[model samples]
Target: MQKKVNWGILGLGQIAHKFVADLKLIPNATLHAVASTSGERAQNFAAQYDAVHYYGSYEEMMKCPDIDVVYIASRHPRHHENTLLCLKHKIPVLCEKPFAMNGVEVEEMIAASKSNQTFLMEALWTRFLPTTKKVLELIDDDVIGEITGVKADFGFKAKFDESGRLYNQNEGGGALLDIGIYPIFLALLLLGKPEEIKAIASIGKTNVDETCHMLFKYSNNRIANLHASILNETATEAFIYGTKGVIRINSRFHESTSVTLLLNDKEPKDIFFEFLGFGYRYEAEAVMEYLSKDVIEHPLMPHSFSVDLMELLDRVRKEAGIFYPTYDRV
Candidate 1:
C-alpha cells in the first residue's frame, strides 16, 4: 500500500477551510497539520479537520518532520514570505495565486525553490479543472477553430471596509489581485502573453482599484477584453472566439463546471462535469501525483508560467496605475 501524503496548511482562512474540505476527497491525502497566527484558530481548525498537528505560528509548524507539503493559503501579500519560509526548510509548497506581489517576488520564490531543490507550484486550481481541460481539448481539436479573441470578467459587490483585506493596500487589497487574476489567467492560458496591454481602473476611497478594465492585444490581431470589479456583480463568464465557432464558459468561469460550444450555423451544445467537493481536489491530486514522481514543478503550472503571469499582471498594473506601496517598493 502507498503511504498517505501528509498535508500541512499554513493559513486557516476561508480559502484554507474550503481547500481542506476538498483535500478530504483525495484518498491518499491526509490533513496532517494546520497553522495560524492565532493559536486558538489553529487549534480549532485542526480539531475541525481532524488534523494530526496544529501550531500557533507558521515557523513552529515548519519544525514538524512529517509534513510532505505545505499549502500557503495566506493573503496575497504574505505569499512570498510564506513560500520562502517553506523552501528554506526544504518542504514542498503549493502557494496560492497571484503567487506573489509582482514578478520580482515570484522570481525570488522560484530561485529559492531551485536552490533548495524543493517542489513548488502556484495553486491556480482553475488550471486543473475538468472544464479547463475540456476547453483546451476542444480548441486543440479545432472545435473552436483558430482562436481569434477572448473576453472574460469576474466581479462581485464587496462590502466596504476600510481596514478589511479587500480595501487595505498594505494587505494587497484590490480587485486586480483579488478577483481580476481569474480573467487574466484565462487570457494567459488561452492566448499566451499579450503584445500590448491597455488598462484603466477606478481607484476607490481606500485607494485600491474598485473596478479594473483591461484590453490585451496579441499577434495576428487576437485580443482579449477582461474586466474585474468589487463595485457590482457582473456576468462572471468567459468567451473564446475563433474563426469557426465560439466557446462560452458558464458563469463564474473560474470555477465553472460547464462550457457551451457554439459552432457556426450549428446548434449550441452544453457540456457538464461532475466533481467531488469544491473542485480544489483536482489541483491537490495533481500536486500529490507530481510528488510521487519526485518532480519539482507541475508540468501544467510550471515556474515559467507563474513568472509570465506575474509579469503580465505587473504590466497591467503599470498601465492602470494600480500600486501597492508596501510590497511594490524596490
Candidate 2:
C-alpha cells in the first residue's frame, strides 16, 4: 500500500502558493493545513486552496496530528527556526533555498535534524527538474567533454524599494541571497567547490550588493564565471563549455524548460522536457521518496553540499563587505 504524506505549510506566500499548486499535481501528497501569523490570512489561504485545517501560529500547525511533513516557504531569514520547529514535532521539513543566513545556522539546523532523526532537505528545486537531470546525464557521459568553462547569470532590474525584502538589510536581502544563488549553484554543480574564489560587486547605498560578479577556479584547471544583479536585467541563461561541445540552457535556467547542445562541427541539438506545473513537484517528490526509504537527506542535494554552498556564500559576503543583521548570531 502507498502512504500519503500530509503537509503543513508554514507560510502562505508566492512560493508557498506554487508549492501547494504542485502538491495537488502529485498523487501521494495532501495539503492538510496552513499556518500564518494572522488567523484571517491563514483562513484566506486555506479557503483558496481548500486546505483541511488552518492555524494562526506555526506552533499550532506543528502540533497538528494530521501533518506528516512541514514545508517552510517563509522568508529566507526564518528557514532555520521554522525547520527546528518542525523537527521538534518530529515532522520532516523541506526548507526554501538560501537555507539560512549563513553556514553556522545551516550547521545548527543539520545538527537538530540529526538529533531528531528526521528528514530535512533544501528546496533547491532545480536539482530535481527533468531538464536539469538530462543536462547532468550529458555531463556524466562526456557529451560536453572536459568542461573547460561554464558561464551563467541571473538578474533583473528590481526597483529599489527600501521596504522590500531585496533591499532590506534586516531580512537577509541583497542580490546575493535573493537572485545570486541560482548562478552560484550552477557553477558549483559543474565544478565542485572551487580552489580559488574571487568576487566583485557594486554595493548599493544601503550596503547590500546590487550587482555582483564571481570567478571560480577549480583544481582540474576548469574555470567558471557567474553574475547576478538587481539594478539591471541579464539573459538569465547558462552555458556549459567543454572541449568538444557546449550545452546552453534557456532563460531562467534555474527552472529551465530545455537546453541546446552545440557540437564541434554539427548543428545544435535541442532537448526539452515537460515539467509538472510550477516545477516544485519534483523536489516535493524527492522528499517523499527519501523519507519512504528512511533516508535523512537527499543524495542529489545532500546536506553537506548545502553546507558547502552556504560557506561559499559566506566567503563572498565577507569579501564584498556585505553583512546582514543575522550574521552576528550566525
Highest lDDT among the candidates is held by which one? 1
Q: In terms of TM-score, which candidate is strongest?
A: 1
- State TM-scores per candidate: 0.99, 0.97
Candidate 1 lDDT by residue in tens digits, 80-194: 9999999999999999988999988999999999999999999999999999999999999998789999999999999999978999988889899999999999999999999
Q: Per-residue alpha-carbon lDDT of model 2 for 98-151, expressed as tens digits? A: 999998899999998899999899999999999889999999999989889899
- Candidate 1 has a TM-score of 0.99
